[model samples]
Target: MIINKILNVDDYYYDVFMAISESLTGFSVNELQSTGLAETYYQHILNQIEMATFIDFLNVSKNVLDNAENKDQLKNAISSQIMDNPATQQIAQSVITLWYLGTWEGAYVNDRSYKEGLVWNVMHAHPPGAKQPGFKSWETKPVNSNS
Candidate 1:
């Protein structure tokens, strides 16, 4: 789908997108921003859906963020207002996929996206053949391993 409008860095919708992403992904804004792909993912979604649908999704997201006063309330709001809502479910899932796996609808977004996937961090590992730990680094125990 062609985006009727492209959001700039300073756009209000961009902020809304990041805020929603943080809530949806269980990551802080700093962690999401650290990936350097937040804007790219936002634009990717715009490229893949109708602007109206995207806007509606953002509106729902913004409302959820605005009304929820605590983490539990935010989680409930997102589950009800975004994840379970037919109009926003697919997009919300796509966002989660994009962050965790660096893929949208099964296609990798980019080499950087693949390397920077949150799944790697969550699993305490890096993408295979990317971000190599170092020569024979695996021979040593993991830093945080319980063993």
Candidate 2:
């Protein structure tokens, strides 16, 4: 007789979620964790989906991370296995949106998520009204701006 294993939220799953998140968002683990939203995001995902679906998503993500040999291969694996697969595509896109936009299903997760959104970092600016760069900060060019 075969038994179906039940999965629960735990350290292993959290680590796998972070790993997959790092891959999907192209953000380093340190950078992602520094936002202080990793656990919240993980729990948010669980709340949005059934445990079995989350497990399946993480399983495919782990497989891709473990087997890919290089950056290009990892990208291709993610594209084919997670993004192209109907079973996981929406979840994967949601994860990316959660990181970059601080929203899930078109709603903001929280104030902290808005303040810590990756989109701000990518654009080298702070979220409007969430963080003030400084007094008269806009008068100066962004520190990292090429122009």
Candidate 3:
């Protein structure tokens, strides 16, 4: 129920991550439906921050999914990463500012190479800045035949 509501507010932005938000945050069915997905997801992430450390966030993000208990916690973490509120949105925006290529989908390296993804394709559109790396940085140096 809560997950359904989160999906509605998030406009289906988050995938099954909403389910973890519902279970961990205890958002009522009605509450989830009423609030924006970012609102709830942001709150959920903040909760995890209190429970985990920086390394914990990174390591757990990459590993927790495999563990059952932590997997439950990881669900909320994924949902939290989707927050787009003005306050927290800045945090998400900051990353793009630091690395523009990571958010650029259309932006390519050299002339032809790996395809980039839209900044807002997954998370929110990154803050404006130099044409840096596209989403996930598809840009790569040409292969060197001479080695």
Model number with the top lDDT: 2
Summarize candidate 1's per-residue lDDT along 20-129 as a digit string, tens digits: 88777888777988998988888888898899999999988888888888889989999998989998999999989999999998999988999999998888887898
How far off is residue 143 in model 1, in Å?
4.7
Error of 1 at 109 (Å): 1.0
lDDT of 2 by residue, 1-147 (tens): 111221343567787788888889999777998998888898888898899999999888888888988889989999999999999999999999999999999998988999999999999888898898999887998778799
What's the TM-score of every candidate structure? 0.89, 0.88, 0.21
lDDT by residue for model 3 (58-135), tens:
332333333435545555544554233343334333323212232222333222112122222234333345334476
lDDT of 1: 0.85
- RMSD vs true structure, all candidates: 5.2, 5.8, 17.5
* Candidate 2 lDDT for residue 5: 23
Worst lDDT 10-window in candidate 2: 1-10
Lowest lDDT sum, 10 consecutive residues, model 3, at 109-118
lDDT of each: 0.85, 0.87, 0.36
| Model 3, position 123: C-alpha lDDT score | 40
Pairs of colliding residues, candidate 2 = none
